[model samples]
Target: MATAWFPLWLTLKVALLATLGSGVVGILLALLIARSRLWLRDGLDGVIMLPMVLPPTVLGYYLIVVVGRNGMLGRWLYERFGVSLIFTWQGAVLAASIVSLPLIYKAARAAFEEVDPSLENAARLLGSGEAAVFLRVTLPLALRGIGAGLMLSFARAMGEFGATLMIAGNLPGRTQTLSIAIYDAVQAGDDHRAGLLSLLMSAVCITLLFLSGRLLRARHRA
Candidate 1:
């Protein structure tokens, strides 16, 4: 029974951590892309959004090439810090983060852009620094929309499959997340396990979707 529940626990942990890390980075990137006058804004947004449209297998392959033990960052980490991301739960978190990033990015960017620039300029005229202006005017105004995106990111991470499978290798009790567990159970003809896992995933995802929608509607009303 404990074994039956392990994947769920692992999936929750991976999704939570992934969402936290990715949501912050995504929101920050969205801010940059939405407000910066830099020429690279469009290019950065395109690269960030690619994960949303690319085949999961293609993304997985890219992850492998960039993070595998022989890969650049992987090699540096292993040699410098004796750390390896391969086949670990941390690797799964990284995969989930990458796959789910676009959700948060899009949501955050839209939210930030919707905030009236006049309000920010008003703060600036009142002697607020850039950071102060963002914190007091832009961020508070955009919080609800960013929250919607974060919830979506959590759901997407909880259901991550191909990239996680590639980087984390479906190691039960170690890195096998709920989605991978369901796949493994189905492949092994364990319908009962698969059914339970599916139910769990469905319930959580539905809840997140519902909450995200409410937040978006509320944001618009504001």
Candidate 2:
């Protein structure tokens, strides 16, 4: 039924957006970590990677407390700009991004690290600016890894449930992403709907996994 699949559709939409946004942020963070000679690089590296070490549910709860309209950052946003995030699609995306950030960070960091430092140094010696060297030399060599990171991040975001539910709630047309929809169907004893959503999510996740694997293998060949 249309009603049954509505939640599934909403979830997929939110997850897709979250994946893109998170992928971009993660790659940027990875690049910063990779290239940084800053005084606190070690400390900053730990901070960026800390989310992966924390429990996801706890992180989600923290997100709600920070980004929810009634929460600190959320309240500030509302007071300053009349913006709200709690119980919305954007909130779901934020939750998913936070939950899956580790995947992107790890993938991109590894990719960036794999580039030979000498190539970048040579470009710099040849009078290329730092930005120019990164764009023309480092990024090209790391493109395959970046692609793999994107696929991994996308798959992880697609499976995000706890954090997204906590921040976004389970509003059918607004925040009922595929994972939450499946959970709701099971709770309501609607095995049929539950099974369908499960299969759909599974298929999507599998496809992403396959793509990531392929990209990683190709990188190995290169």
Q: What is the TM-score of each candidate against the true structure?
A: 0.92, 0.88
Model 1 misses residue 121 by how many Å? 2.3
Among all candidates shown, the one with the greatest TM-score? 1
User: Mind giving the per-residue lDDT tens digits that candidate 1 earns over 1-222?
Assistant: 467688888998999999999898999899888988989888899999999999888898888888788999888888999988889999999999999999999999999999998999999999999989988999999998888888889988998999899888989889999899999999999999889889888887887788778777977787
CA-only RMSD, every prediction: 2.0, 2.2
Tens digits of lDDT, candidate 2, 1-222: 677567656766776887788788889988888878888988877877776787777888899788777889999999999888888888888887877777888888898999999998999999999889989999888888788767767777777888777778888877888888889889999999899888887787787678778877877787
- Write down the lDDT that model 2 would get: 0.81
Model 2 misplaced stretches (Cα beyond 4 Å): 125-127, 211-222
The lDDT values for all models are 0.90, 0.81
